[model samples]
Target: MPSTPHRWITTPLTAGLVRGALDLEPTAQGILPHRLPAWARDQNTDGQLAMAESQPSGVRLVFRTRATAVELDTLPTKRIYVGAPPRPQGHYDLIVDGRPAGRAIATGGNTVTIDLGTGALEHGTGPVATLRFAGLSDEDKTVEIWLPHNETTELVALRTDAPVRPADASGRRTWLHHGSSISHGSDAASPTTTWPALAAARGGVELVNLGLAGSALLDPFVARTIRDTPADLISVKIGINLVNADLMRLRAFAPAVHGFLDTIREGHPTAPLLVVSPILCPIHEDTPGPTAFDFSRLGDGRLLFTAAGDPADGAEGRLTLNVIRDELERVVARRAANDPNLHHLDGRDLYGEADHRELPLPDRLHPDAATHRRMGERFAAHAFASEGGPFAEAEG
Candidate 1:
């Protein structure tokens, strides 16, 4: 065992800025991050909702330290889908002085096993584990520990070889983004690698992500949350979750969008608000969904989702990606004529047919890590570039 340093400082976890999480509450074990606040979470009792809200998709611990070594204690609940391949271990992405430093995985927490055959869940709790990083430069620098995007983690403690302080704001524009699983980092490599996070880094902006997996159903509560939050730039990525859940028809989706935007506008009446439609998801482009898990591939240790709705259902108002894109374009165009602060970006521009050929979405529903990187880079160029961009004039 390595000898312990003679002196160390323990900082309260709350001392570090935690972005992207809507709520933080004390748990029996530690402080748990919630993408949705307790009141919002209380409105839904579904297991999927519970799991998704607790995952802390874009939450990160950011502080300034001169420590040569640091340690974080966390109790993570790792989920296991029975009959499928084991998930990769949850990881914390470490960023030092605005650059990727390394990654660390905490071991021995809790395991949640789900049986597909019976729809039963078995949870086993374990002890908290430490993730230690050593050999740092020992110079005062900003340190960001991006929480695991997939696992439900409860932060236990933060310890360092030297004192730490909250990091100073970089005076960059704050980008507040809301969307579905793709934005929530579905299959991205790590929390910092998620498309939104990547775009933030590329654009030199601070990010407050409101992407919620299996939960971006254009809910009014979410809209109000975004409206209330402080942001210099705002974006709402819509469509996929509604289609996959078969939540509503076109008649409802359009009005729901209007209402959602209305709520956001109530708080951010003049902030540059960008409306983004769904990307080119071939399976859901023309076909409506009620996406289903492809069990045939599950036997091969792969979990894939396929659209189950009929293409002919369009006449019945079934929502599809194409329909969503058209509606979003119309909505943004109609409103933009009167509201110069509002803008629209075709999701296809971010991940379209051309990009799909080179870097495909591995699960057919979410972009892989590499695809995420591409999308981020493209979004930065299109939205944050100096000339002919919506944000160009606003920067000054």
Candidate 2:
């Protein structure tokens, strides 16, 4: 009897098969899920959760099974579309059955092509024959490919081996993160260097980055996106964007957050989701957010606020960090009795009083790389540490 080809090896963009034929299931678009490539797992590397960086080594694919004999087949000419950042520069490694197969490098946009060898059956009687790749650095990275498994085999598991320590699959765990431009990492450094990435590294769980720069509008879509993704933990950092963008009124803010969490419950059911409010922003701490500035002028003194109304004025719909924090606590308290998994973390807890006093955000918006590192460490200790309250059981 011949060994069976249990699973198909393809990029996330391409459809996967659960049993037999190609299953075209519609995944939630706009919202990005942290996915690991097959090759990442083969190499025993814990790939980044949400975003990936381009590396000189490409990703690989590995197959695990109980069959005695196995065969190897390569697609003639296939395109691997990568959801990478603009002007990506790196190489990709391709591996098969723990052997180096080939390499692919980023060209114009974010697509790489690899010509697999002849589609012939190779004899293999091992429990697992992993296809792996190397060559991704800490930059923006995303790739998709098409590798169809033989219809005769059984598909067991799929994963990516990233640089971080592999997470335990035993108990359920969830990680939630929130932030401003720095959290979103507008331009400071590479993709993997973002606070969310660092934090996820420390936590050892999947992440849903809700750090929308110039856009964390508390929009239904943002909340809906969070509500939709499955998770064991959750957090939301709100403030900077609201203040800088000057998008909401105080009256609407509290209810909006409630609605956001409420929506998330629809999908997550009973997962531990932490609600993180904004940190201390002096400019917006006492003043109402939604402040405006002219993009046309800056150094010339042409910059000016469009409105004189104070966000502190309770009469108006203006917002402030302090006010948002209070409301968040109230919202959680109101809903806590009904939902045991619901929790809240003050952003200040990660980078509060002392840290802010020492290092303020550059340009009054984003944190520097050091701050990102600190934030990651603090988050891990508070949210994911086993000895801690919320994530204690999860850590086990």
Candidate 3:
């Protein structure tokens, strides 16, 4: 808990003060940040996506202030694991002048518990919590207060020692990326530390992250969201969610992929578009899914994921990482011939068997903090390096 300041000035949270989110919804508490607009959200029935898109993976509050002390009142929704070790409270990271600065965690709010075996959920409500940061340089500087990547939060109020205003744009190209939990900051240390956020930092670009956890299926609405959003660079990391969720079989996947890309091209025909496949996940390398929680270690307060589909089922057109990767390669190769701005990068180039053996995923499904950093560094080098990168400034 931070000490309360004497003469606090309140600043309303507005869309202009936010960066990375597509829409802002007014809430009884204050405002809720949304990665997808209301219209797009209304089209989906999957509860996972509804939860994921509202988690605000790449969303942050960007403003200019000379306040040495700042306080934010928020109502964050946290997860409670029954019969398992507690999940850490989500983090609030502060970035100043493009540098890592302060970090805080909200104390209390709403909570939800999903039963491991039954898949049942229970909710608990709590009071709003205040996150505060004090004793900073008083001179004007841009401040980015990054919300948690794994928790949904409502902005109740913002107070500062000095008056605050929206920050100006960075004058960098905007990068729009969509993918699964890996891209959505699962197990990552914080919001800005997610692979996409880390890569965006290295690329010196504003970020529009659509990396919804466990919800990046080849949905038309997501494609439309990407199509309508303004972006200078675009990338889609596919395959993991499709495999783990077992949403569509091979017969439907190809056309779904084609249609998804076609929708994106309609709005961004000339934008440098990169199609990335899944990284190495040996568990799903050959096995199809429906990934299941590996309960063998739950007794030890550890949670791991395992593929639950049969191997012989491949003949039935079941989707696996290998099959998805191959099809994605073919799709990109064929499309690139006609669409010069379109490109493909094998996700293995970002994280392959060799790297996995060195730094395995902590939960067998998502990368840990260190792995996120490694992936971010590798992705940045491949996608943003001065020369030989498909996303180079002169790509289009």
Candidate 4:
């Protein structure tokens, strides 16, 4: 550790470049990062939306410094279900000179406990925690700290042996992706290891992840957000959130999708826009959902999810993965006649029956870390390879 107190610089946390989040709100103790702007947030007061948007999945702190040692102070908000095992600490990934360097974990943070049956929430306060990394090369370099994807991180302070400045943008094409919890980094080992982050690295693009866990409900506000954000490439992963929530039937889903695409096109008329359907989830493959928490395993300290709707309910406009896939394909095909930039990809191509056999989803919902890696690699190859793929540079 550096001994000279006079040499240490306390850089304001707001000085670092924060990406992926749409807004940063100043709080009494620190700065709170939010995925949705204040306007969008005010539109809904649902706890689900509040929690999902506050977890900055792809947000990172990017700066340039010659410091060999650095420390960050943060207050993270972690959630725990009453009957489930305690959740793990949040992870912060560090990158130096565009390469993976090291990772650290935040030890103390506030905890929010929830009773699923009663819908009651209890909050507990915890002290802020410090994350420190040392032994970095003395030479000037760019540093990136990927914030915990599943935790609501409040930035308290940033200290380093040397002064810090925001790093220059890489000038890579920005790929804006919007999806559900799967895209929000659930079950992924770390923030940067999330499928979207991995795919961004492989595709050599900047990622603006608008993945709101359990909140990809085809809201007009979300479509407007996408329509207003600047981007070179855009993709929306549809269906899973809808099916699992059982929010809407086929009749409403089709028009909602069309409206969503129409809104996006108003801003990005020529950008390569890819529409991806849900990947195969065996439980939801033929069966409809409003997936329910499986409490059978809770006695053993294991929390699991199970499909709760009947497969035969499709006759009443219920949605299944199969039903969603067919409708998405038809919608894209019909719209593509006039919009050459629009394209569609079946989620099965990313993770199909064969892949599922080798790598199963732990919760029967979100993919595990290894599966996330596979999906990222496949997505890069399918959409970003030089072989006239949907996201080819030629389109630009």
Question: Candidate 3 — which pairs collide?
Answer: none
How many backbone clashes does every candidate have? Answer: 0, 45, 0, 0
* Candidate 2 least-lDDT 10 residues: 145-154
Once fitted onto the true fold, the runs of candidate 3 whose alpha carbons sit more than 4 angstroms away are 1-6
- Cα lDDT, all candidates: 0.87, 0.48, 0.91, 0.89
lDDT tens per residue, model 2, 254-351: 77887877887887878777777776666677676555543344444332333324754745767677777888888888899999887788888877
TM-score of each: 0.96, 0.57, 0.97, 0.97
Residue 112, model 3: lDDT of: 91
Query: TM-score rank, highest first?
Result: 3, 4, 1, 2
Q: What C-alpha lDDT, on a 0 to 100 scale, does residue 197 get in candidate 3?
A: 95
Query: What residue pairs clash in candidate 4, if any at all?
Result: none
**Alpha carbon lDDT of residue 108, candidate 1?**
91
| Model 1 agreement with the true structure over 265-372: per-residue lDDT tens digits | 999999989999998898999999999887778667778889999999999999999999999999999889889989999999999999889987777888888988
Worst 10 residues of 4 by lDDT: 1-10
State the displacement of the C-alpha of residue 353, model 3, in Å, after optimal TM-score superposition.
0.9
lDDT of 1 at 294: 78
lDDT of 2: 0.48
Q: How accurate is candidate 1 locally (lDDT)?
A: 0.87
Model 4 misplaced stretches (Cα beyond 4 Å): 1-4
Per-residue alpha-carbon lDDT of candidate 4 for residues 273-339, written as tens digits (9 for 90 to 100): 9999999899999889898888887778777889999988999999999999999999999999999
TM-score of 1: 0.96
| Candidate numbers, best lDDT first, in rank order | 3, 4, 1, 2
